[model samples]
Target chain A: MDSRVWDNRAWLFVVPVMAFVLFSSLIPMMTVVNYSFQDSMGQNSFFWNGPGWFQNLLDPTTAVGARFQGALLRNFAFSFTVLAIEIPLGIAVALCIPKSGWRVGAVLVAIALPLLIPYNVVGTIWQLFSRTDIGLLGVALGRSGVPFNVTQNAGSAWAVIVLMDVWHWTSMVALLCYAGLKAIPDAYYQAARIDGANRWSVFRNIELPKLRKVLVIAMLLRFMGSFMIYTEPFTVTGGGPGEDTSFLSIDLVKMALGQVDLGNAAAYSLVYNLITLTVCWMFFTYTTHADSKDVA
Target chain B: MLDRIGLKRGDEVHIADASLELHAGSMNVLLGPTLSGKTTLMRLMAGLDRPTSGRLVEDGRDVTGLGVKHRSVAMVYQQFVNYPTLSVYENIASPLRVQGLPKAEIESRVARAAKLMRLEPMLKRTPAQLSGGQQQRTALARALVKQAKLVLLDEPLANLDYKLREELREELPRIFAETGAILVYATTEPAEALLLRGSTATLREGRITQVGPSAALYREPGNLDAARVFSDPPLNELALTVSNGVAALADGSRLPGDGALGALPDGAATLGFRADAAAAAVAVGGDGRDPSHPAFPGTVAVTEISGSESFVHIATDAGLGTLVCLVEGVHAFEPGDRAEARLDLARAFAFGADGRRIAARPAAAPRREPVPA
Candidate 1:
């Protein structure tokens, strides 16, 4: 017989959160779903279109489809670029931070300052900082005659957006990595040292393995955050320079709010949500299952 | 051999006057409770931590500056710290692979170590996937595969369940017997030190008070601190004033002072003995009581029955603290029962006011009653 006592009343504590989720997320999500299947004009009039917008969005030949495809590729490139730079840089920064002393607190707070800044404020700071006429970096580069202009050159816009995003978010990854590194008991390192492991071997065998679960969290957060990046780029570049920096969220906002294309935006958003969910699911499944399979 | 004398950190001293020499092909157990600087001393030996004072000399060379990676040392921790992501084979092979060994050599060593640890069948498994014992075995196998000259175990089996602890405790000495390494094992339990049968060092408050053969240390703890560290339920202590060949209890009760007790100078002293050295019997007849042995009247406060032995804790009428008597069988003495505890004064040790052992104990005599297994 099972020895576990079944107590369902404990779930009463979760009812508030469940009700909040229903009101905050599920109802809106259902509304988006409802919008995806119907065509709407002005004056709240709606007509059933039977997935017309979805078909156009999914087909590469259609205008909406081609736009979605471009934005998706841009999102992928941006997410991958930032993650590749941020993860290693974060780890290196975390390693460089002193393990103990008066400086650790100061360094950690400084590292976390960028993370604490509001996204739009960060965007505005970068926008002003990168302006050719008055910005610190922009004037310096302009004086060097590199022909830097986020408005006129696609490369400049892309570089600035990537750099700005990196500056704002790499600390977050570093903080997570630092916390993960700190959580590892000193015994593992001591044992590794006694085992004659060199510097690289210690990192490869002990530190890296211990940091796996934390890295998973960092990767997922970075991936999803970068994939749907809107505020900073929108504030600085506004998806300018011939759509060089327009990510999924930026393009979706332009389509829904600027162009008033609700049908296409709703369909676009559902598929966008689906892709993010799918990637996260794959990551979650692969990592969590791989370790549990090889039991003795 | 390592010497750690007066280890100072800032203005405070840790491990003062704690010097020990660990010989090859022998197990040296550092017996101490928590925060006794056991780990710090082991770290100094392993070259993981440098002693603020004294030298850790190996083969007549000072290597205090060299880091642990440069030394031939292996340490197993209380928490089984096997690489969570690596397979058992890879985990065992870790140290070997780090030494730049060839593929064939690493393979052979890992195979042998795996078989010895009985982890051969689980070579494909990760530490997270193994049982606690198997995980610890993986850690031990990692230490074993390196063939290091010095092996330090910081309470390796402390985290295991009681049964697993027992099993590994029996298997550990056998595992180390074949190796000629200088093995240093740290534990808080006196029973474990005795069972391991090594030169045991008793540490208290960061200082080692005694170091001798395991049984010798138990029979003759040179100081009160060492004896207290070596006891499980703790060595019983009673203040005594010795004069005219008699020791006076606080309540004006008298105990016959003879042998080791009589040898002490006529002055204030304390008597210390193991639980087994004292016996609690019915106050009326006092069966099996020696005529010369004095009985201290006490009321039974509590009784604990292990499988083979029972410990009767009696609150003595005398002002001295409660005395615990080890009985061989389950007497089931109830609380509030009037009793008299007959202490074996012949075997008891007397300590001076400075907490130094004042009595010169007799040479080794076979124990009359074995401690509870």
Candidate 2:
């Protein structure tokens, strides 16, 4: 194995990226930390509170605690729902796509189209598409008289948001799976055939086990993306009809930018970041532990 | 016939029709060069590949269409075909599992196979972790784990070092003896075929050219090509002519060998004899009148000595052309030494112009054992 050398020369290439990240993230983080330690009196005047904002965050009796927990639960629910629908569907689509020559190129282009559009554009497109008067989906629902109004209805808004996400991001999972599928040597399939494995047995014994790594990666990415979802649901529902469609990020933004309580917002942002990190860490630990158990 | 249970690549009708009958408990070696379709034929025999035209028959019943898994025939391929993902134990037990055998039976068979192959200690190791020889043994054990009726080995020892090959060659026969199954092994080496100690078949260009016991084929090949196929240094072939009672050569020198010249057809003939069949001696005092043992005077052209014996390539004026005489013991003979080469009368082979073996005359009767009487 080639041991890595701590070449200061390589830092020349990485320094720009680090600098950009520091400017974009570290500076804002320091500002948040500064705000998190003080209470803002009107006109940017601050009084030192010394973890007062953290105490308010921890206390369930506080208004902030109640709203944060509710939004967190809703975020978890949304992420799980999207994952439940997308992973298997993505895998199925990937498997069904023809794997040879020109046909694969066509299928790849078709699958990649949804991922190529910008994130905000995706939100705007869905926003317009789900409108009652101008959108085909809304028009069809209206024609069918299926009482559908995503802006006012929490269930409908959640369904549309989940569907929009599955439509946009399922391709990522499919592409990963397709790559995994392509990497499998044809000899393995030949061996399976010689073993007299039926179709289901082939899938169970070979395909599923081989796909384990990529599927976990796909699940983690989808979970993180769906958990932090903001643009599409926010654009469509405006976090409106009360707090019906307000996810965790939506609530955090509402506190930060809507209420202009910089101290409280900074505290909420820190809590939000910690929650995402904790969940992701837990997921990673669970999967790696399960894999080690299986290997043993 | 294609109807045999062990028919590998389907036999083609356009080719010569031949059926192989290997008795149970016998080891049949398929000997041929690479790409000569030995592996294809073995796969057909193992029921891995179906012959498009012929039927595979087992005990007079057609089994041509049966798949490899259902045939109860195990094949160890030329390539290391062990399952990379499975440990040695699992690989051996796979055949039993496929057969839907009981757990106890599977366990016993796997244990017995691992023990026989000396792979018990490495049962938990994956194929990649095993050495080349160990991997090959695992492949062999996997075949033997299921009580297969016919075991096909496709150059199973080709990948091993010479030392390992020698060791495994000694080990394999004992393993086969214990199993009591019909073993069909293919190899490019004639020595391997000889080591098999059973009936041997030679394949060339997808056709079986010859089949017989190894010793007989080595000693008295069926034809000129078969004779050439057996010898290590290869048999020496010379063109000869029959005129008067002498076999005259192109150099116009007549041989003094006492052969049944009367038995040969008049005109051209190719005399075939192995290098070892010629007795090398200095100009000896003998009449050379024996009709069986013929003699020729020739100049030694080349001498290759290896330990106990040396081969002298003789350039003779006789129609024998170039004769290789095998001389035992060390002799101080340079390339230009005048030498008398004697043919081991009974051992010489004669081939006709069309590359077929010609019959020789009946041997002279041996003298009675008067002293014993």
DockQ of each: 0.48, 0.10
Q: Which sections of candidate 1 miss by over 4 Å?
A: A1-23, A290-296, B242-246, B251-260, B285-292, B334-338, B361-373
Candidate 2: how large is its RMSD?
Answer: 9.4
Candidate of highest lDDT: 1
Q: For candidate 2, lDDT tens digit of each residue in A1-296?
A: 98987778966999999999999999989999999999877886888988888888777789987887788888888888899989999989889889896899999999989999978788888888878899988778879998878877877777778889999999999999999888776635644555555777667756776787789889999989988888877887877658877998898889989899788788888988888899899889988886665521
CAPRI verdict (incorrect, acceptable, medium, high) for model 2: incorrect
DockQ: which candidate is best? 1
Q: After superposition, how far is residue B187 of candidate 1 from its true place, in Å?
A: 1.4
What local lDDT does model 1 show for residue B162?
Answer: 94
Model 2 chain A weakest lDDT span, ten residues long: A187-196
Model 1 over residues B148-190: C-alpha lDDT tens digits?
8888889999989999898888877677657778889999999
